[model samples]
Target chain A: MKYVLIILALLTVLTVGFVGLRGQTSRQPPVMVFNDLVDQPKYKNQGESAFFADGRQMRLPPAGAVAWGRTPDKPDPGNLIDDADYYGLKVIPLPVDAALLQRGQRVFNTYCAVCHGGFGTGNGVATNYGMSAPANYHTDRLRQVTDGYLYQVITEGKGLMGAYGPSIKPPDRWAAVAYVRALQRAGNAKIDDVPQNLRGELEKQP
Target chain B: MHDRRLVTEGIRVSRIFPKNSRQIAAALGLGVVLFGGLITAGVTYYFTPKYTRVGYTPYQPVPYSHRIHAGQLGLDCTYCHTNVFESPHANLPSPNVCMNCHDPAKGNIKGDSPLLAPIRDAFKTGRPVDWVKVHKVPDFAYFNHQIHVNRGVSCVSCHGRVDQMVEVRHEQPLSMSWCLDCHRNPEPNLRPNELVTKLDWDSAKDWKVSPLTQNTDSQEAFARKMVKVSALHPPTNCTTCHR
Candidate 1:
């Protein structure tokens, strides 16, 4: 009888211990409940603020203050996009290297590819959303527009397009511009653009 | 004679209290059984997945069904939630964005329906539709939609089968441990960057060779390679989300 009582106590202890461990595994309530900022009363952009003497959340930029990383609007002498005709200045203002072009390709695919298709044909999936047909980069009309014109359009949106100035930084924007030029050049490339050996091999194909 | 009578009386008194060893054993048995039953019930109740708001389908202003749009017509998640890839907030679409397709000027596809009256009124008045936000994490826990989307996490990763949901509900617990499960090893959930918006992207059905490299490697291999090459460095430190 003594042994049976001892066994029962041991069994009870084991069961209680297991239950305690299981309870520990369950989620404990956080020390403080989550403070939902969205639901909190706050001033939105351009919204009225009683807290501030000036009734607006957005303050005007100081005079002569330029945006971060943007060069002055005045064209630099060495600037490749300055007064250059479309096909005239083939060279990129920034150093042209394999890495720069590769980086440009990535940036272009992320931002520009939605409106201008992945292959620059302007038949993006965004067309389904009732967006007006984007211009095809392969056309001679786009090919004739200078690189500066493309940069400006991207900076200050043209036609139905919204400005991407805030989202894409200046350097990345230039990279996208470089990528656009590469796409056009590739679209209009001749057989001579291929290596001499590769051209012979291509001609061999019946 | 007196001693014998006293011993017999003591035994009889003890029997009145506990009856016999059989009765005492039965009472102990009952106590053990009761203890076991309560403990089992307690563990099952506390540990059940049903506790963490699983089927909490809240009613919205407009009964916009993801089932018809995403499942039937096969509209991508990105069509409406435009900034999922670029911003932390998966922005609710303004009425003008909705008007692009369902404008009265354009063929009023479903415009006249009473269900859409609120949308029409908001569009006409330029007042925004009050969309009820689902799947909101705690304000203190920072979740960046862009980082996850860009790093190859799909919509279906956290929002299980959103395409099939008629009315979206909270599926995952969104708990700290639930998040840590993915941040620890994110290989299985990862996909190619282009397919981030594609909620139904299964690696098994349409496997392709890696275009990133010239060599012929499986898509899964490509994803694993990307995890390394991108140097994803998903921080496990507390400050990553808490701060």
Candidate 2:
């Protein structure tokens, strides 16, 4: 019994000497025990390439001599509007419906509402920093503009604004235009514009 | 071979070992087995990804705070990660996107600050900033941000309150068992598709609880309805993620 007790005490001391707990902050890379295809030898998206002079896999080639598989990018049927029509004060190609307005509201809240106020009043949270007054849709200058003109400005940004053409899809841009028009109408609505039944409720507000 | 017992009986007998020599040898053998088990348990606990992958906070080349940008500023996740709804990968924002607000001549919010030098340099020199990706599953496991975000899995579900994290940390293990835990039962982690980006969204407080829209008093019923409506069948088959 004494020998068994002594052996157990010695084993406990050795076991406690070298073990540390898990989930501690580790700056070192995790050692992979099963690295089956986890680290593949291939080019991934936006990966650096030592073979290129610029070390960028996504950069434009430096004066490459050969050109192949190039197609003339003009008047694609997928765009649903021609370049001339899009720039020539064309109407919105998509159907103007509740669904379009809802989509417009969502996209506007995500992208535009950061600078433009949620209500398009040019008083967003960004203005609290250093941004100048974003264009207020309530102003006569923006209210009088053509729908195509608004679309063009959004696609190809004007003076201070950056072009959203790359980030936002074209359909969402049209939806935002429709939503901007809705905000303008909602801003300017008078008592007569309200439904006859709901006018009493509007007047009842304190 | 002689009568050694008679010969040594007169002298004081000395034993090289104790009287309990058999007991000591048996105890030593048992100790070896127990010590081996302790080492095995310690290795299983401390050496796997469950321990190593969590709490990994690598120092980024240029530090950016998700807490200030996403939490305090209230910038939506999609504002920068624009392709999550459409593409499998949630793309990192190009430097031009950063320059929209950080340009020295333009929006000019801390534009000249030394902290923003890397962003401005990338914008001018056309080289990408080396932002270390923190939360990554192994290359073998395929994770689609589009499918998860659109199906009402909030970023907080897997990432664990990223808006609150000043520097990104690997909050979850990202092991296959961790992924399977959610894939097996995802009701508690789900919300409406509309509010997926709102990190702190709560159905009881944020959503309207009315039977008219079938957003009933019970939040579980609503989440189950969402699963049925979206037809979410998260596959547990081998090829689903490994492929």
Candidate 3:
């Protein structure tokens, strides 16, 4: 009995020595004991497929496919929409409130801050790497441009800029325009613009 | 007790057997019992999904570091995962997204590094890079990223502090019981929807130091209010996930 106990103890130590403790980082895939229908042979989104010629589960949309729902069609072939002035809207269609501006700021920081700078002063992080001529929102030319024109620029690439329409939806684009206007106003703020209650706080700032 | 023939007038029926056969049989029986119990306990301790799936770290074609991009550079999570809010799956970014910064143009960084060769090749060839999927669910399970994110479940709660990990290992067990642990009491994990992507937002640090004080009014208090506001009752039905 003593010998049997000693043999069992040595065997246990040997097994543990070969395989490290649980949760130790390993490159091997997990062992799924009794994989009962856990991994079926059905196609998954963005999964590999053996049946398809391209070996991709996701199929690209057929050529010239017209969208049925309220989806935006393909961007104009060469930077020219049908109604330039009409689509280049001067007014924001949505209600301009604090909530709208909050969302606009969130969207702007996520999508545009890398290239356009957080303060919209043409000094974004991308500019340090070689991004040339990110438009400064504080400039007179940008301040005077209509909201629709800004929307169009965001949807279509100007010069070396890329189109962000596919990523940012339409309402978000309008909100971003509103945020750009707010940034411009903030950059050119004067003492008179401060509210009477907050004037003391503004004066305290260096 | 065994040698009755030596004690009285009795015949020795099995002289070929060993004198200490009983003790030998008893020792063998006890050994079998001990080994049986050890095997049962070992299997129960080390052979489960929690043990097998916890630390599965796989190698990828591109050695992209979340520590650098998401942590040091402070890029928002949604910059690459654009469709997380809209789709069930948190889709991977295409190679074109990588070119936005590394395109060897006037001010791009590391345009010609051999490490980024696969990304450039995929971008030029219009082919997808074979990025290994980490954190996968069973085929029968239906996990939605949008509902969880939109309801203010931070990614850090499920995937530990990914920004700190050089290569993200399977931080959580992601077992069925683990899911129930949160579903039963989700207040601890809840935060503001706007700060869902803020992986490093520490409540105690923010409550004491942050100026804005967005949801700094005690984490439990905020989570309780959010539960009331969002009607946060995650179902515990097996069909909820198994479907």
Candidate 4:
């Protein structure tokens, strides 16, 4: 009986020791539990800062700071327009190429495809998810709009459409404009648009 | 007291206790202690939030049914989560996005249902709906959705079958070790970029059709080869997640 009790006591000690070895709860570490950096003395954005003379966290730019690279003062080459046509530009200022169209397609797929289907038919899958039907690019009205106008609509957003300017860079937006034009042209492709060798096969699709 | 028997005795002490009752009582006590310890550990292990969070469905402002939209109708995950590929954060659809189909003016579908009151209110008021977050990591950990997505990790890898969920719930224990298990060996989970949004996609089935794996002997070998070709290297260093 004594030996049994002795064994029980030893087992209890072992179990307790094993449990103790586990230390504190593993969920929350204790190393930096009460670190001062979490509650450090700091100024919030645009808040008052005692260290600064103006007492504002936001500092004004230096007096002679002209914005660098394609400065607003550089006279936009008269491509940009400001009128009732939704401030739509009259001409595309950037150079266009196959790479730019490819980039535009990628950007359009990533951003616009949810509303403007992959084929730009305005029948994107989002229409089933309780969204309004987006405008189709194949329409004659949209086709006549200048490239600048398309860029402006993409930049500022049109009607119920939200602006893509914040997410899409300006160059990519231009690329998208170029791609939209391509889609519009593709929608109304003439027999001449097809290659001479492929025209035979195209006409054979009775 | 007289029941004490020395261990050095030549004869095997078959009966140490004075009565069977005492032996039975001792056994019962030991059994209780062992079972008690086991029960305590078992309850602690199973009842902790980490383990229990799997089915924790929280109440949301709207009763949106992912099962109806995603399962029955088969809308892609990216239809609403528009910026999942380009941005670190998955962008929630704006009220205008909902208005695309549910516009009261259009009267297309479900325009008058009271269940869609909040959506209509948000659209009319230009206010955002407050959708509660289901899966959350510790504040210290940094997660970028775009990087994981671009690397061919499917949305279902961590979220489970969200299409079938009426209301989304926590599916996986977002623990450090749970992440390490995948980061250490990501080959099995890797899929083609096009199939990332396809929740029920099977890499094995794809092997037979894929041009890359047509000449390969088996699906397993092809998957491993594709993993090597993609150059997927999910880092495990602390700075990868912490800093």
Please report the candidate that would top lDDT against the real structure: 3
Q: Write the per-residue lDDT of candidate 3 for residues B3-35, one digit (tens) a residue.
A: 765655333434545778889989989999999
Give the runs in model 2 whose Cα sits over 4 Å from its true position: A1-20, A33-36, A59-85, B1-19, B203-215
Tens digit of per-residue lDDT, candidate 4, span B101-211? 566775246878888888888777744565666665555567888988888788988888888888886677666888898899887777666667777666767667767
Please give the fraction of native interface contacts (Cα pairs under 8 Å between A and B) kept by each candidate. 0.02, 0.49, 0.55, 0.03
**Where does candidate 1 clash, by residue pair?**
none
Ranking by DockQ: 3, 2, 4, 1
lDDT of 1 by residue, A40-124 (tens): 5654423445665544454556555555554567333323333323224344557767777786786676656766778899876
User: Per-residue CA lDDT of candidate 4, range A178-204, in tens?
Assistant: 888888888899989988987987897
Write one digit per residue (lDDT tens) for candidate 2, span A70-168.
334442433555333565565677899999999999989988888888999988888888888787889888888888888887777766677776677
Each candidate: chain B TM-score: 0.80, 0.86, 0.86, 0.78
Name every residue pair that clashes in candidate 3. Answer: A89-A148, A129-B107, A130-B107
lDDT over C-alpha atoms for residue A206 of model 3? 92
Residue runs of model 3 more than 4 Å from their true location after superposition: A69-87, A128-133, A204-206, B1-26, B105-107, B212-216
TM-score of model number 2, chain B: 0.86
Writing each residue's lDDT as its tens digit, candidate 1 over B1-243 gives 999999999989887777576877787787677667766876565444333344556678898899876776566575567567777877666565555445555434554678887789887775555565556565567788999998888888888888888888767767777888888878877777767766666665555533433353665686678778998667899998987
The 0-to-1 C-alpha lDDT of every candidate, in the order given, reads 0.67, 0.78, 0.79, 0.68
Candidate achieving the largest DockQ: 3
- State the lDDT of candidate 3 residue by residue for A113-147, as single tens digits: 88889999878877776677788888889889888
lDDT of 1: 0.67
Worst 10 contiguous positions by lDDT, candidate 3 chain A = A74-83
